[model samples]
Target: MEFPCDDNRISIVDLPEDCLLAIFRKLESDTDRNSFGLTCHRWLQIQNFGRQSLQFYCSLTIPNLSPLSQVVPNINSFHLYRLLSRFQQLSSLSLSGCTELPDSGLNPLQYFGSNLQSLYLDCCFGITDNGLSLVATGCPSLTSISLYRCSITDVGLEILVKACKALKDVNLSYCSLISDIGIRALSRECHEIQAVKISFCRNIFGIGFKGCSQALTFLEADSCKLDPEGILGVVSGGGLEYLNVSALSSCIRGDGLAAIGAGFAMRLRILNLRMCRSVSDESVVAIAKGCPALHEWNLALCHEVKLSGWEAVGFNCHNLEILHVNRCRNLCDRGFQALRDGCNRLSVLYMHRCCCVTVTAIELFKYIRGNVKIKEEELMYIGPKWPFFR
Candidate 1:
């Protein structure tokens, strides 16, 4: 037999292990990684070792825990404690929508708390205050947690903030039971908190945000009963980057918006004022002048703002990229033209339900290289479907 010693005949297996690992790292999607892993045993081992985050979504079809236990031996009896104990290297764990998971399932987490950095328990209705208390006490090193639509109340939140002082981000959105008490506790205890989402938590008011940590950057309180006082309290923190006070028609007015424009001038990047009927041209102009860093802005259904205000925004906020003027009956072609002229960086424009915006002005927007989603009715008259229109 003749031995082939040509360089062109070198197989992929001949490459160094570190080189193969580096190649695998370049694969972006899980499907690509999995396919690469099946090529060889060494690749499979590297892929398995690279997998550090685990997520489990139990279905009613597999109601019995026996089959799941066979697949993931550590998750026997739906006990999270046993699972965490086995996967000591896990940095992130998500048990979202696990309604069957009980309080006892979290008891063993204390042993592996230091290893955990992020946890998601969204819509886990079966886990009550007692279960949440166990999580707070156990996960001392946790930096982020999401309890969206959970049954956790003020008592559970108090326990969590007290224990997880290192927490940076939290999401209590749609948690109906969370009130001012819980918000106050979180603000006072978690001084390092950066982002919070409390939208649809009806009981939360402006007072809940008072004296919040200066480190606070993002806040979402849409569809809540937040008043001007609450809005003032949030802006007073000064480090805010993104703020959503949408649908607070009864509370937010010219004064509140002016306060936001003044306080968040340097840091504010995104602002959502959807359906804030009280917002007028004066306040809009004030916001444009004050917030130079403002990029993405939503003024949908704010009918009080006219062409003059938008013109000012275009001139002042050069960095503005996204603008939503849906249902703003007062805005006309002249205003949009001014806006287009001033805001050279405008990328996404929503002009649905604005009857005053003529087809000529819409055609003018076609020249700009960005997305411009108009109402279906408006598209019919425009003839050719542009690639940018959606």
Candidate 2:
């Protein structure tokens, strides 16, 4: 037996500095980043020199100032402030799901003025209009902003929207403070806006969107207190390309969704009607007949729909690519078979918690991406398995 010392030898000295920096930047977990930072002097040097985007879940146990910390420690604050100053290259920032951080901790974006672009503060309990103002004023060039479940008021949104003129994509879903006034301002000021998601923001019912000429590519105002009048108003505005209003939690079952199906069906590309228990199979059929351009649809958690609803969607929407029917116990294998039979361009399918659907549904739906998954009955209903995210 000959010992092959040459074959076992590995060297980091030959690797380029840029290549090493790229490796450090690719690290997803902050713990891993900190570990790599401790490996060697060479690694530390590369980490400091490299420009990297940081996404923190905000826990006090994470060594540095957690995103949950309402009052950022002086040392960590100084460190983050210094990092942003030295590396003006930081662009993407997501502080979502950290319920602990208070308003003070989130206001530091003013220190990062003009550097941040993509910001996701979804489900952050500490966030309010004041914290939002800091980001909008500091990051004037911000294009993408998602603030779902934040306690952002209309006043805060108004100020922030005025500051962010170049905004193209925004998601204010479940921001209950927003009213028709905020929507009206967005319609008036944000002319370049392409996508606006205000799901369950039930304030924009009777209020009108004045600027309808700019051609908005997407609008998701699902489950707001909408009627045929509100639906007609949005469609008449002349900018919608994608519309989602599956569940209104308030008035989803009435003629609002039907008005959407009949009025704006020509321009829509995607629609989400998840958990709209009020919506019956008749509404789905009407929408399918009206919205000829609709391609992607989500009917998750809707118990009212039956085979007739699935048949209409399958028959009319030939370009459908993505479909979500999670928790819809009414849809059986027959509906899955119909989806498989008609939808040729389908790529993503989510049928989580649909008891009527078995593993057979997953096998039938073609073109599913690697990201999509199907949970078993016991696991899906009882609790999540390991490596699965809720």
lDDT of 2 by residue, 208-269 (tens): 55444355766777667766566666665555666666556564454446666665547776
- Candidate number with greatest lDDT: 1
Each prediction's RMSD to truth: 7.7, 8.9
Query: What is the alpha-carbon RMSD of candidate 2 to the true structure?
Result: 8.9
- The alpha-carbon deviation from the true structure for residue 310 of candidate 2, after best TM-score superposition, in angstroms, is 7.4
Taken over the whole model, the C-alpha lDDT of each candidate is 0.76, 0.68
lDDT tens per residue, model 1, 1-390:
988779669887888877887787788987897798787777776665555576785442245576546342233334665566555667787877576677777877767766688888776777789988888877898888888888888999999889998888898989999988988888898899888888888888767778788898888787887876777677777788787878874666665667676645468888888888878788888889888888788888888888888788878888888788888888899888888778877866767878898987888877664454443322111112211111
TM-score of 2: 0.63
Question: What's the true lDDT of residue 135 in model 1?
Answer: 86
After superposition, which runs of candidate 1 have C-alpha atoms over 4 Å from their true positions? 1-51, 59-78, 253-255, 363-390
Off by over 4 Å in 2: 1-49, 59-80, 97-102, 106-108, 204-215, 218-223, 233-242, 250-254, 280-286, 298-390
